[model samples]
Structure formats: C-alpha cells, structure tokens
Target: MNFLDHPFNARAGDIIEVSLDKQANVRLLDEHNFSRFQRGASYRGHAEHARQSPVRLRVPGT
Candidate 1:
C-alpha cells in the first residue's frame, strides 16, 4: 500500500527525511550496515525496540 510508483504530495526521487519505528520495511540509504527490511524499517536512534525487542511482538505485522 505504501510502495509508491508516484507518491501523492511527494515528488518522485525526493529526499524525504523521516524517522520510523524499527519494524518498518525500508532500506537504509547508507552502505555499511546492509540489511533487508521485511516488515518495515526503524530509525536506529529512535527505536528502543530495535535495541531490545519486547517480550511479546511490538512490530505491527509480525
């Protein structure tokens, strides 16, 4: 639903600065730590769950 061919109100190839939960399905724009996001990606600085996941699942999908 979010994968945009053409994002509304958002221009294509625009560098949209954003922060997200650790479970968000996204790839980092950097090169060092390369990992694929299945459910979603998270903001490393903001995602406490990424450091230590909850006993139960906190990720929305899985």
Candidate 2:
C-alpha cells in the first residue's frame, strides 16, 4: 500500500509501525519543533515501531 495515497488514521502520541523492504532506506523527521528542528533516526532493511510525532518520512535524497 502506498501510504502517501492512503495514510493510516492516527492522532498525536499514537504508536505506529512501519515496515520496509530490505533495500529501502527511510529518513524520519520530527517536524513538531521547527525552530529547534532536529532530524529523527534513519532506518533501513527492517521495521520500526515508534510514537507518532509531527513527522515527515522520506527517502534520503528525494
């Protein structure tokens, strides 16, 4: 499923899981604090479960 087209319904502080094919690299970002913006962790080849923050997910280089 393409999450960009059909995103899951979630609210703040909810825990969400993301799964990726072994070759995918995803960069997760916390956009909640733009003034003190800090990048979240990067993951590849596995699934990750984390609390939902104001975030954006992308491949490393557009």
Candidate 3:
C-alpha cells in the first residue's frame, strides 16, 4: 500500500529517473519520490499489474 507499491497511481508515459550509479537497480527506484531502493526489498503486489514506465529525459530542448 506504499507509494511505490501502488501501480494504479503510477501512470504509463510518466517520467521516471534512475540514478547514474553503476549499482542502481531500475525496479528499485522510487516512483513517488526521489530516492533509491533498499537492498533485498521488494515492491508491492501492484508492480505486477503496473504499466510499462518510461524514463524521463533531461536533455537540452527536451
């Protein structure tokens, strides 16, 4: 029931940003905030029904 666990709240085509750190896990990234996921932690059940999220762009003119 947490923020990241609620896939219904996360819309497709939404902006998702991942850390540049080499050890970062895409699924571990927080969808409702700017933070990294903890090790061995799992997302809520909603993740299974979640839509395909795309990464947001920070490039110039974007």
Model 1 clash pairs are 21-42, 22-42, 23-40, 24-40, 24-41, 25-40, 25-41
What 10-residue stretch in candidate 2 is worst by lDDT? 32-41
Candidate 3 structure quality by residue, lDDT tens digits, 19-61:
3423322342344333323333444311222233343422222
Question: How well does model 1 score by local distance difference test?
Answer: 0.30
lDDT by residue for model 2 over 5-48, one digit each (tens)?
A: 22355555555445544433233333332213233334232123
Estimate every model's Cα lDDT from 0 to 1: 0.30, 0.36, 0.33
Model 1 C-alpha lDDT per residue in residues 1-62, reported as the tens digit of each score: 45312122333343444344444443222222222222355333112223322222222221
What TM-score would every model get versus the actual structure?
Answer: 0.21, 0.29, 0.24
Better-scoring candidate (lDDT), 2 or 3: 2
- TM-score, candidate 2, is 0.29
Higher lDDT: candidate 1 or 3? 3
Off by over 4 Å in 1: 1-8, 27-62
| Most accurate candidate by lDDT | 2
Worst 10 residues of 3 by lDDT: 44-53
Write the number of the candidate with greater TM-score, choosing between 2 and 3. Answer: 2
